[model samples]
Target: MNLKLVVMVFAGALLVSGCSTSKEEMLPAGDHSMLELWNGAEGGGSTARQAAAARESLRRPLTGSERQVDAQGDRSYSRTQEREITQQFPRLPNPDMVMYLYPHLAGGNTPVPGYSTVFPFYSQTQYAMPGERTEAL
Candidate 1:
C-alpha cells in the first residue's frame, strides 16, 4: 500500500512539471527592441516629461549654511598633525663579546687553528623604555 501511494505522487509531480512548457511560452510574442525601452518609449509611455519634472524639483537654491557644509563636507582635515618626536637620548648599541677557542685537538688528534667567534653576551635584546634612566653618563 505504501509503495502504491509513493508511485502515484511521483506520477502526479511529473505530469504537473511537463505541462509548464507550452508552445506559445517558448518564444516572445514580437520583436521588442531594448533601445526603445531604454529611451522610455516602452517604459511607462512617457519619461522625458517625468525627467523635466524631476529637474524642476531640484532647481531650488541652496541655503547659506547648507552651501558651507557641502563645500567643507568633502574637504578632509587631520585632527592630529604628523610631527617627528625627538628622543631625549641616543639609542645604545648592543655590546658584542668575542670568545676564543683554545688550541686543542679537533678530531683524531688533529690540531685545529685558534679561531675566535664573536657573539652577543646577553641572550635577549634589551630596549630602553620612555622616562627610564638607562645610564648615569
Candidate 2:
C-alpha cells in the first residue's frame, strides 16, 4: 500500500511536470540589426541563385537540337511486345509426375472409379532468369 502511494505520487508529479508549460528564454537576446546581418562578410544561402535559374528555365523554351530526344514517329529505341518479352524470358519448366490410383471405393458406400492425376515435381513454380537456358541440353 505504501509502495502504491509512492508510485501514484511519482506519476502525479510526472503528469504535473508534463502539463506545465514553461516558456523560458534559452539564450540572451542578440544585439544585431537585420540590415547588419544581411550585409555580413560571409555569403548568404544559394536559394536566390537557385530561384533565378528556375525562373530563367521557365522563361525560355529549349531548341529542338538542344532537346535530349526528338518527338518524331521514328523512335531510336525499339519497344518489346508481350509475346517477345515472354519469349526473351521463357518460364522454366517443372516436369509433371503422373500417378495412377488402383480401382477402389473412395467411401464405403461410394464406388469411385480409378483415375490418373498429375503432380509437379517441385513444390512451387519456378521461373528462369533472362537469357538463361530453359531447354534441356
Candidate 3:
C-alpha cells in the first residue's frame, strides 16, 4: 500500500512538471482579432476613422522656415549647390553582369555551322565583357 501511494505521488508530480504554459501559447491564437471585435466587423468604417485619427495626430502644418520652396517657386540648385549635394551622396556599387546565349543563324559571315553563341552585357554599366560565361542561356 505504501509503494502504491509513492508511485501515485511520483506520477502526479511528473504530470504536473511536464505540463506548462508558454507566453506565446498563452497569447490569443490570432493577432488583431480582439481589436477587430472591439472595433467592428471587417471593412467597417471604424477602422477608417481610427486610421484617419491616427494620421491627423501624426500630421502638423509646416512653418515658414521649414518650407522648401522659395519665392520664385523654382527649385534652387546652383552649380556650387549641386556640387555640394553630389559630394554628400555616395554612388552605389555596380551589379553583377548578365550573359545571354543564342543559336547562330546559318549563312553568317563566319565559317562555323550549327553552332551557338553567347553575348554578355553588364546591365548597370551597359558594357559587354571580353569573354562569354554564364550559367543561364
Top of the candidates by lDDT: 2
**Candidates, ranked, TM-score:** 2, 1, 3
- Which pairs clash in model 3? none
Q: State the local distance difference test value for candidate 3.
A: 0.59
TM-score of each: 0.29, 0.36, 0.21
* Total backbone collisions, model 2: 0
Most accurate candidate by TM-score: 2
- Name the weakest run of 10 consecutive residues (lDDT summed) in model 3: 126-135
Tens-digit per-residue lDDT, 1-137, candidate 1: 99999999999999999988977788765555767655676654557767788899989899999999987875545232322122444344568998999888978799987889989877776655566666766
Ranking of predictions according to lDDT: 2, 1, 3
Model 3, 110: alpha-carbon shift in Å? 89
Off by more than 4 A, model 3: 1-19, 22-25, 30-39, 42-51, 68-137
- Every model's Cα RMSD, please? 21.1, 17.0, 19.9
Model 2 quality (TM-score): 0.36
lDDT of 1 at 20: 89
